[model samples]
Target: MHLIAIDWGTSSLRGALLDGKGHVLEERSHSRGILTVPAGGFPGLFEELFGDWMRLTGSFCLISGMAGSKQGWVEAPYCPCPSGRVEVANAIVEIEPGRIAIVPGLSDVHDGVPDVMRGEEVQIFGAMSLVGLSDGLFVLPGTHSKWVTVKRGRVTGFRTFMTGEFYALLSQHSILAHTLDAQAPLDEVAFLEGVTQADNGQGLLHNAFGVRTLGLFERMPAGELASYLSGLLIGEELRTQSIHGGDLVLIGSPALTQRYQLALEVSGNTARTLGAEATWAGLHALSAIHIANKARS
Candidate 1:
């Protein structure tokens, strides 16, 4: 059966029409994120967005991301760690019986603190499928970067770092903001320099302050400082992680992943990246699980 994989996040909504083999036939994206819809408007909005595709393809829709959060269409309870697509599918909150359902996000505990992930789990599963591995270290870089650990196709544990958010706060609202261009293209030299500095014995607080000093002392140009600051933050994140075996998979947009790729290389590690299509493939994989379970019962 065809699948409609909808990744509805806080700031954007995107859908993919997938054939039986999980290949995307068509895709649609919009700014109508979960926050944009009214309290009672989710069903109406979903229908408006993909009603045609559903009717035409006889597709079963799987909604993922913030759309399954407490604020989205319906809050699907968090499925605990060590969850695979089978567990996720079993916990899915069905909106229309067999026709539509929301994929529940995964939850894990790290050092006595609880952690949760909504959309990133789908990407991780998709990345594993694409790379043909059941176990690996995966990092999803975004506003809140995630470093996830998977064992035998089930997510065992993960950690979240506010690297991107911190970068935004520093580059836009901190003293470093005065000397940095947030939108400047990546400068590999300046970025790698920052990466090297981050790996030093100095911690993040000390390394971060260097961004402003580099500008104040006229040591580094204002144009390259943004990339430098970014490298420092990403490098700090890498420094904290405990990477085990398997390929270190990076999943996200190219621009963000490239910097991470560079940072990973400098740290003497290599990475493979998968883009947004991972979301589509992930939902499709979950759909197959749902279907197989139904047939068994």
Candidate 2:
């Protein structure tokens, strides 16, 4: 059976028309994310994005991300940790009679702090499957970077860091605003210098102020300060959370993952990147389980 995979996030939506073997036959992307949809307009928005592909009958639709949040088409509850495709498949909501379903996210309480992720779980599983990995550390970098641990083909635990958001707030609204030039091309040397500087143990707050001093003293050009800031924040995340020596699987856009890969190398760890295709692979994996369940029932 053909499948329609939808990755509907906060600010964008992506859909793919995939053959039975999970190859993309057609795809569409739009700026209409959950936050952009009008109240009670999800069905309409979905149709507008996938109307052409929906013309086919009996094709199953699988959705993930904020579309399953409390504000989305329907609130699909969280499945606990150590979950596999079967668990996520069982949590799928029948949004429409035998036609559409929403995949559930994963939730875990780490060190007594409750945490949840809506869309990244699918990508995590997909990365594992694509690399033929049964266990390892996986990093998904984004607005909120995720450090995940998979064991025996299941996600056991994970933590999140607001590195990107922090960078944005500081560069645009904080004291570093004047020190950064957003349009500057990345200076690899300055970035590595920041990463190395971050290991000084002076603390993030104190280290952040140094960006201003460095720019003020002309130690580094203001144009390259953004890359330095990025490296500092990413470096801090790696220093605190990363294990020193292992092959880390980095997943996300090439542009973003490359930065993380460099930071990993600087921090004495090996790394590899898996592109955005893993999201579709994961959705397909879940849908296969759903199909099998339907057959048995």
Candidate 3:
């Protein structure tokens, strides 16, 4: 069976055509994300890309991410956190005439703090399939990073951090951007040094400006300084969150996976790396789950 899986994110939309075995047959991406797609443009874009497949195979479609947000095609309410794949899949919104289903995101209120996530829930589900049913933590690193805990196939609880967005703003938009250059390869040694500093309990807010100062006063190279700043932010996240001592699954691009792996090591933890293709795995998993649910009904 062929399936259409859409991984719609805030900044981009990625779709894959996959066989019954979950091997990708073809894939496509568009920069026209949730922000770019006008109020009613979903149908047009969906048709433009997959109209041919719809005519030929009439495959079922399952989607995750901002596609279910208020701005997207439909508003699938969030399934509060601490829920499992079965719970999330059960909450899917059906768009009929065609069998397109949107997976609801997750949200919860803990300690008077309300948090939400969209894309990472699918990722967690996909990761669970690969790692098997276990009690552990899954760490997804991106614009909005998530630290998710799973036990017995249910996502028990999770936390979100603003590491990626903070890095972007500090490196490009903040005053620190003026003092640094973006032209050099990452400096592994300097990065580890920042991790060490963070592990030693140096507060992140206090250390953030030190990046610019290091470059200006001590002649720290721009490239190494950039990597150092990145390490500092990520290290602070690890330190504050205490991500060590658990089974850690790091998800992101290879470069990011490596960085997080290094951070985990510095913090006296071990982590297994999941490839960036986990997004595809997630989309396909949602598609298969939805299709099976339909068959049962």
lDDT of 3 by residue, 167-274 (tens): 899989988798676556778898887777775555887788888889889668777888888889889888767554767788777878888988888757888778
Cα lDDT tens digits, model 2, 14-57, are 98898889998888888888999989999987887787777786
Q: What shift in Å separates residue 48 of candidate 2 from its native position after superposition? A: 0.6
Using all chains and alpha carbons, the TM-scores for the candidates as numbered come to 0.96, 0.97, 0.94
Cα TM-score of candidate 1: 0.96
Kindly indicate the candidate among 2 and 3 with the higher TM-score.
Answer: 2
> Could you tell me which 10 consecutive residues in candidate 1 have the lowest summed lDDT?
239-248
Score residue 138 of candidate 3 by CA lDDT: 90
Ranking by lDDT: 1, 2, 3
Off by over 4 Å in 3: none
Which stretches of model 2 miss by more than 4 angstroms?
A: 244-246
Residue-level error in angstroms, candidate 2, position 293: 0.6
Error of 1 at 164 (Å): 0.8
Q: Model 3 clash tally?
A: 0
